[model samples]
Target: MIDSVQRDSSLLVHFTLKLADGSTAESTRNNGKPALFCLGDGSLSEGLENQLIGLKVGDKHAFALESEDAFGGISPDLIQYFSRRDFMQAGEPEVGAIMLFSGMDGNEMPGVIREISGDSITVDFNHPLAGQTIHFDVEVLEINPVLEAANADPVG
Candidate 1:
């Protein structure tokens, strides 16, 4: 029998991600290798993963996902500002440049430069895919569901 998600505890899939305009954004087929990932580990988005459940090996699917359901809708609060002095400390800000900086709590955050003016630079911290819908075309190349009945270690 083809192993379904509930019957198989985990899965390893080779995927091809595409944009709404039919452009290929990423794919495992190009590297001549497959990408392995555990299900329900947040490696795949919830909405997308939810759609994958119950599918067996060798199943091909194409679907459209909304921005909110995909990478998530853009957030207004993600837009931030940095003083000219701060910009100088980091480096010069160039339009369309992605820069990594420490947040107030010292956590690293990536910000994209959108504009620069006399005393401040505008940065957008939202994910590049934040506001755009994505089209996903996935194939279930393999399935490795966990075997609860197996005699091996539980951690594996």
Candidate 2:
């Protein structure tokens, strides 16, 4: 018998994400292979993860999440303007081009070019999907429950 998904269960699933307008944002179904990940691993938001706790193999589910529960609302602090000179070695900036910038913590963050003035370029660091509701369609392909240690005692 197949086990149901639990908080720490590892799962393989096929999923598709759509916008409120019914436009597909992303999907694994197109590739014909299920994606695998462990629960609570941060691959999905906590709100979305909580919804997967009781699914079994072969089960299909669909739901929608508001902006706050998904990528979240846009943050004004993430929008900033940089001097054009900083991108000199990279060539001229074009609007809508995504560029990676190193953070103070040494991790890279992607920023999309929004506008280019004479000496300033506006970059928006907010996620492209921010402020939009998301629709999710999911099919659970496999589930592996957390195994108990061999030395552990079972309680009746």
Candidate 3:
């Protein structure tokens, strides 16, 4: 049977992300490879995965998502200040640089430098694309049905 994108389909696709201004933010095509993932997996956002449903192999599509539906709106609370000494071990911090900070959960999170003062640096923890609309150009390359375990029994 021919495969199509559905709730449990696995898909291989190439996609490009662009800003509202037409600037390309990222593209799997640029890397010469397509992304492979299953629907409902964390690899693709729910909003984006929903858009792919019903698409068939070799289908191409373009769409836009608002800030709230994309990466979400920037939060003032995510903007934080840190002492310069904290980064002295790394080097002089520069505005526009991205730094990895340890979170309370013991995971590293990326924060971008937004400002530098005498002894403090302001970092924005929000995603770089936060608060901006994004355009997506996607091409479906392959689609496969989700595999069920051999031991699984079919139920009505």
TM-score per candidate, chains pooled: 0.79, 0.84, 0.86
lDDT per model vs. reference: 0.78, 0.87, 0.88
**What tens digits encode model 3's per-residue C-alpha lDDT throughout 1-156?**
666788877888899999988999999988898877688767666788788999998999999988877788999999999998889788998899999999999999999999999998999999999999999999998888344454576798
Ranking by lDDT: 3, 2, 1
What digit string (tens of lDDT, one per residue) describes model 2 on residues 1-156?
A: 547988777888899999988999989999897777688777777778877889888999999888888888999999999999999898998999999999999999999999999999999999998989999898998897333454566798
| Residue pairs with backbone overlap in model 1 | 8-145, 9-145, 9-146, 10-145
> What's the lDDT for residue 118 in model 1?
84
- What are the per-model numbers of colliding residue pairs? 4, 0, 0
Off by over 4 Å in 2: 145-156
RMSD for each model, in Å, please?
A: 4.2, 4.9, 4.1
Worst 10 residues of 3 by lDDT: 145-154
Worst 10 residues of 1 by lDDT: 1-10
